[model samples]
Target: MKKYLIKKILSNNVVLVEKNKKNYVLVGKGIGFGKKKGDFLEDPKEIEEKFISLEGLSDFEYEHFLETTDPKIIEICNKIFEMASSELKENLNPKIHAGLIDHVNLAIKRLKEGIEIVNPFLFETKLLYPVEFELAEKAVSILKENLEITIPEAEIGFLALHLYGGRGNNDKEDALKHSKMMNRILGHVGKKLEIDMDKYPFDCQRLIMHLRGVINRVEKNQSLERSFVSKLKDEFSYEFKIAYDISKIMEKALKIRVPESEMGYIALHLHRLNSYKH
Candidate 1:
């Protein structure tokens, strides 16, 4: 039997361990209790679960997640991703590891405290992504079985959105699409308006994040409330035109009409970017 040094205790049952210069997360009842950093695993039999960090989970982000999150939460998150990967025929995004654990932990806490937060996008999420919705429904079963907690039906749709975004293929494709769209928009503005946004990398990054949210909303057919489109257009005509051009691209690519309110928001961001350098 080999002794593993405890690096951190995430919960009473979960500990980050280091052996032979590699990191592993161990989960077992009482495995982490009474343990401190540099303490050896007293008994191997106490180990109920282990995730090898060297294998497909070496990123510092995952390491930090394993170190900070509860073991049971991590276990449940792993199970959800395992089931989703097998059912959907795609690898779930590793980043979802953190998000799911954090979400489910808070959700369990919220329910225990009698909080009832509604998922506003539940209907659209279910309608737009039926397959992921089904997977999330099944996930609720796993939660009920293991966590012994009943989640709201709307939670299924919320989980579906998370799972859908975390699918590896879709994640990569969406990233590529986002990058292409950002470049196209910047190129269009650079060529048509002759503004070099490359000089403002921070502003460009903010715009990228904004576009990411826009793409996600468009993909899910989510729209904002009506806004003062005419006033916005009048006040920020140049930025609004750029926003309109972006709307055209989004409409052409996603086959959904871009909402004027969303365009107004985009124009606001565009105006900020334009004002930064002009």
Candidate 2:
């Protein structure tokens, strides 16, 4: 039996322990209560509800997170991770630990300050990642229960994105980058149309989902049929022009050329959006 020695106590529920020359962060209820440095912990597996291996993780970032973030927030994140792991039935990327804690802490702060950010990709996210979205709904419930605050629906989308990114073998950065690019493109669309996209949530969601499909097709070098291109270009010249400009934006951002066939599809969506403005 390997004996675990406490290296440091992050909070009442979190402690850094050393076993067999390996360091791990142990998390559970009162795992660190009355614990001191160099204290030996017997049967760590019996007591620890969650254990995070520090291997290949940035020490400075972990230390900074522990030093700066609220312990209550950390505890909540642990619970979220536990629930996610059980529901997902797989190991999540460890990188999400800091990201989730930071995001939740900031979200709570923003909500308290009455600063709410509208998530433009909410509909697309929920539609694409149904499992993660469901998990995010539960996560919001946990947040509401523990913090005694009402989390907005928009936050659920953000949480869903995080949960989707944290899933096994998924790159968190890529998930975030995809959403960010969509936001930029939507911002440009709103600017070009000279209308607030938020006011037309359904139309905006349709446009976002269309863009997501376009991006997927573009990345895969897949081409849509060109049968409607001429008709769309001739019938909705203004929307087609805006869609062309959006193609240029996508080309620059994704480093992939947008096919003209796909541009027609985008124009079709834009034409619908244009009607909503009337």
Candidate 3:
């Protein structure tokens, strides 16, 4: 059996352990209880399923986070991760641990201070990742049950974004940047149409879905071939102009060129949204 040497105890339920010269954070109920550094865990099976690899992470930074963060918050994050893994049927990116804990801790602090949390991309996030959004809803319930505090829907949206970003090989920072760019593009569309998107949830959802698809297609170098590009430009000059501007915004943020055909599709969506305004 592989033995683990206790390296550090973060909490009664969490510990840093070393095996084969690699470190991992072992999380389980009472895993660290009555344990100290240099102690050997003879049975690897005891924490076989609960260890998070610390590879590719800064040890100092992670240790500092565990030391400073509330243990209750860490426990909650672990619970959420376990639930997500079970439901998604896959292991999540362990890098999200520290980030989620920090985010939740700050959100709780803000709530205590009576500061309102708002998510401008709530609709977009939900539309983009329905499964993650559902998981986040469950996470909100977990937070409320444990902390005795109500988590706002805005926070749920943020949580969904985090969960979605943690899946597969997704980079959390890149996911967040993509969401921010989508928000900015929507903001531009709202400004150009002189309408508040919040008032039209369906339209906003459609636009966001289309934008996401456009982004995926553009990143994969897939361009749509449309015969009516000139017709779209001539018929909806105003909407096409706004779409062109949005393409530029996307190009700058994504560092990829937005095809004119894609701009035509965007213009059609814009036209539909503008029609709803009148």
Candidate 4:
């Protein structure tokens, strides 16, 4: 049973749950609508177990049990709860909070076992990358059913905060400023890591979202900024110079421009490292 904290009760047995008040998805069940906000959805484990001992169960029944009543789904729900508790933003709109938590919970379930991602700087989500709520919802659905990988919604905000500050801070006015920052880091990663930033497994669509949001200041963005380049040089430890040098390779393969913003991104990581030293 996926234990959800109900956010809103829709008519016709459809209810929305705010898993961590970050992401929301609709739950359609007979009992879902009656549950009040902050109430936990009944555990699916008991329901699943009841179906297991039955003989000659119909395929449809078993499919439904696997989808909705599996114990493993409950375990995934719990893991998502942990991530939401640790990573969620404070003071979120209830709808957004619910969506984010639900998204994370579902995402962990989708990941293929032993899918190793090697990024010192950020958590790489393998799912469809979304720019807004509508896109996120649509992507979440596609990912939940089809793909076994997904990106968490708040990762962009977290990376932004790491490089700059809080959501309430420079996010509104500082556009080009961040573009420069991400470009540097991308450049660094391209140069130093065995991981390919442009090819599959580490494909273009995902990287583009990270680039425009975390490093560059672009609206309707689809590529990296200059700042990401700088991150590799100053903050990479032994990985710094190697990652810093790879900007040229990325630029050539991806046909993306690396500007002053990349320099700024590099500087921010360097500054952070320097501060940590003293």
Candidate 5:
């Protein structure tokens, strides 16, 4: 790759570069030091942090972001996206660039100012978006290493939300609501049955997978009739009752009625988990 010129300085570490007649935004510590427009970097190869802009498209948000946001913050978020892309093997939505930069900037500012906020859906976020949560964890570590800032765990949850929005199909807020309901239902089952959910990883995973599918079905209004629901209820009364309790919570949390078949499937999972000795 040929070295690019400094077309403009967006920040102390961020600069606009042109290569092969396409514009790119480069971010690195001191990459833009004492540089002016039309001044080519002696080693553009040294600019390891950069994102290519969509060809011939005017991304006003990205442009405004480069001008207004801190380059260090942008650099941090870029590493996160790079990590996510590498791990997930998918191209994240470029639209997330500006939004994530803005979020990181504000998050850092709030942390430096000693203001803290809690994420009510933190647990749910971890369970629901495991991969994204991992990326967020790495992002926090990077911030600590580069900026010497210890971000709150709640911010990691928030960053996971941003990553989920950037990669997944569900609306970020709706996904959080769904995950919260699922966790609440699982918690209720464990309490009612007096079972240690951690002891039965397979059963727990099964329940989570079932509930995830249930959410999709419910959102699509796809009704599934369960002919064996009554039989299962009679055979496993305890698990059936726990399932009923979970159904109520889901109904309340999701504001959608859960079908008996769905409850029956969930009860089967609960039965298996409760029956396990460990």
Candidate 6:
């Protein structure tokens, strides 16, 4: 199916399209047609492959994406590349980069014909919920803005930690206190660097790693709740989003193309104790 950049979604399922020239296209019933203008819609089934476009991804993400992956991902990556600006791309690590492209493609595809996430335990989650979906979304956005990457799936889980009540008893007071604790530590560190951890463009990989380490101290020294380590682990999943951002910051600060995605995966494995023993 060839796509058209919608110049005008006409009345009676008709649209004005353009490809070098403008024309009105009719979407006939029983014979579906999706065409547009300005939108570089290629009929791979019709003609040969030519120049590919990156519509949504940043420069760093595009460079890494083009280096790896097949043309299929590229088609999707093109949209991502186009969507992102060069400045945004400069900050992504490959892992965050890869995850961003892959998930965005999947999300857009699913959403197009109407789709949704269907968890079997959705009812159970709603009943004795451990995490809030909204908070997870917030976490994911924060990860993207700060880390120069985004993973909608994992952040949902990370933010959902509020439902689990994260280490302390599941109470508002505890949540507020933990928020303050994390913020205070970040604030102090930010001050030393003449940067606000709250505002700095550091990846979550280093941030979470630092946080997880501090969490260990809390649990060990104070007989903190058993859930603390679990909380840290949950938060660790968000590192994928952050590490990608860190790559850019590192590149800017250190002038290095440090295999951002690889570092993110390494951090993930470390967090799960998958290969590297703690």
After superposing candidate 6 on the true structure, give the runs of residues whose Cα lies further than 4 Å from its correct spot: 1-135, 138-162, 166-172, 196-201, 221-278
- Model 2 quality (TM-score): 0.78
Cα RMSD to the true fold for all candidates:
14.2, 3.6, 2.3, 15.1, 5.1, 19.4
lDDT for 211 in candidate 6 is 42
For candidate 3, write residues 50-83 as lDDT tens digits.
7765555576876776666776777788889999
Q: By the lDDT metric, which is better: model 2 or model 3?
A: 3
Q: What is the lDDT of residue 139 in candidate 2?
A: 95
The TM-score obtained by model 1 is: 0.49
Candidate 2 whole-model C-alpha lDDT, 0 to 1: 0.80
For TM-score, the strongest prediction is 3
Q: How much is 44 displaced in model 4, in angstroms?
A: 27
For candidate 4, lDDT tens digit of each residue in 1-278? 45556554443344444444332334333645446767766547532221112123345643443344323333333233233333444322222222233334343544445443333323232222122223333434443554345545444433222222212343312432333444454545554454445443334344445344433333335344544555555454454443344344445544555554553544344333334334
For each candidate, what is the lDDT?
0.71, 0.80, 0.84, 0.39, 0.77, 0.39
lDDT of candidate 1 over 49-132, digit per residue (tens) = 344243445567666655555567767766787788899777776555556666777787788799996865454345445688
Sorting all predicted structures by TM-score, with the top scorer first, yields 3, 2, 5, 1, 4, 6
Error of 2 at 232 (Å): 2.6
TM-scores for all candidates: the values are: 0.49, 0.78, 0.89, 0.26, 0.72, 0.22
Q: Candidate 5 regions off by >4 Å?
A: 1-8, 16-49, 52-68, 194-203, 217-225, 251-257, 275-278
User: How would you encode candidate 2's per-residue C-alpha lDDT over 1-278 as one tens digit per residue?
Assistant: 56689998888888878888777777887889999999988865655547665555477866775677777877788788989999989877876776887889888988889997688777656755679999999999999999999888999988988888787777756666666676777788888888887677777767777887888887787889998899989998988999999888878877889989988988888888778767
Judge candidate 1 against the unseen true structure and give its global Cα lDDT, from 0 to 1.
0.71
Best of the candidates, lDDT: 3
